[model samples]
Target: MSTLANETYEARVVAASEPGVTFSGALSSEWIKFRTLRSSWAVLLAAVVALVAIAGLIGYVTGSKWDGQLDPEDRVASAPLQGLFLAQLLIGVLGVLFVSGEYTTGMIRSTLAAVPRRLPVLWAKGVVYGLVTLSTLIPTTFLAYGVAQLFLSHFGHSTSLSAPTAFRAVLATGIYLALVGLLGSALGWIVRSTPGGISLLVGLLLIVPVLLEVVPGQWAKDISHYLPSAAGASFYSSLQADGALSPGAGLLVLVIWVAVATTVAAFLLKRRDG
Candidate 1:
């Protein structure tokens, strides 16, 4: 072959052999890492089991007491989704560990080396974790809802998926949990330590809401609705309370929180050494 032709053929071959890095590649890597972690699977299983079990148990108890103890408003508000109170903690902890675990094991150095652009790693982790949470939680929510309603039906208090606001509430539960998971992942990136990430997550989602109630003012009431847990809960709440955001608004608020948290984490990841 002519020298020029040989050079051109070699260039083409090299280009074909290396497709280069992409968001999809990073996402795939993150997904593989996520699935390989036994702790991740355990946490996910625990969340699903807790959601379904607690929801069914609540339904049974509500049904047993429906004759005289349960009031109309209570019946309307007592969704099997109350199990989300437990699911959120489990899912959030998983999110924290998703990134923090890498740091703890000193594996982040290899991860960063694989993706020198850096930000894609954070984006990939967030997207993969969010999708996993959404996919798993949505089906689990439906299962819990179905099983719980079976028991509640005995007391004539069961609500169908076709009932007003029923489907939206169930759908929102998944979205809420997905956002919660992303929020925890973002916090993990920022804190880069499992204990710190978990502590901040628990404080932000659980403790702050309770402490806000003790402030005693319309101002505190106004602020309370904007907190992460409060806003997320508004999504699946069948009945809107006085201080809560509407479903659409609550979803928007949680999305904003996730966006802001991830953006900050991205900035830090890029600026700081791995």
Candidate 2:
């Protein structure tokens, strides 16, 4: 063939090799879609406001106490989780909606059509939710702590973030939110319906504890510690002080839950159709 013909052939091959975009680029596209959603912003703002309000109340009450025996460290450590239960619920729902909303609105078909490999879509949403959860949790936690400390100071019972346990508790709480969001995303993937997934999540968080309490064995309490919400909430040192679970133990349990949830979600995604 002539040199011109060879050059034309090479150009054609290059265009075919490029196809469209890389997997990472595809993932970025999903992230952009997720960030633009109104629910994402609303849930995140709710988490922050709730955290500050609840923690401020806890700190304010402790500051006004007449017992004169309350431990400031314990109060400070526990302050981060004051609104965690409520915040986690919102975060979980947001994570679920991130994926299930797509399914409900028939957007997942478009997503899958663009990226036939289904797992990447899940992975991208997981990454985006984790980032968004972490971003919201960090600032919300610190602001909550700051507000709490402000009220506590007026009563001469104050705390500082410079303390070792204070810092650890803050870090753990924020990380736990991200992990919980990811777990919710996984459950959302497995369930694929908004109401069903939310119901399952609420069951996991609330009903399990009630069931455990009704049972009649020490094993029940011990095993309940392994549940995601149970263990995750242990990040709140106030609750941990109640001997529910140690901080390290809580972290381990949460990691196991996330691992199991993610694995199951991946399997279901591959097996299920869009």
Candidate 2 overall Cα lDDT vs. reference? 0.80
TM-score of every prediction relative to native: 0.92, 0.88
**Poorest lDDT segment (10 consecutive residues) of candidate 2:** 6-15
The residue-by-residue lDDT of candidate 2 on 110-207, one tens digit each, is: 88888787778777788878987898798888888888888888787777888657877777777887887888888889899999888888888888
Clash totals in order: 0, 0
Summarize candidate 1's per-residue lDDT along 1-274 as a digit string, tens digits: 6746546564555456667779999999999999998999999999999988987898888888888776555565437778888889899999999999999999999999989999999989988999999999999998888889988987777888888878988888888888889999999999999999999999999999999999988998899999988888788878888868998899899999999999899899999989
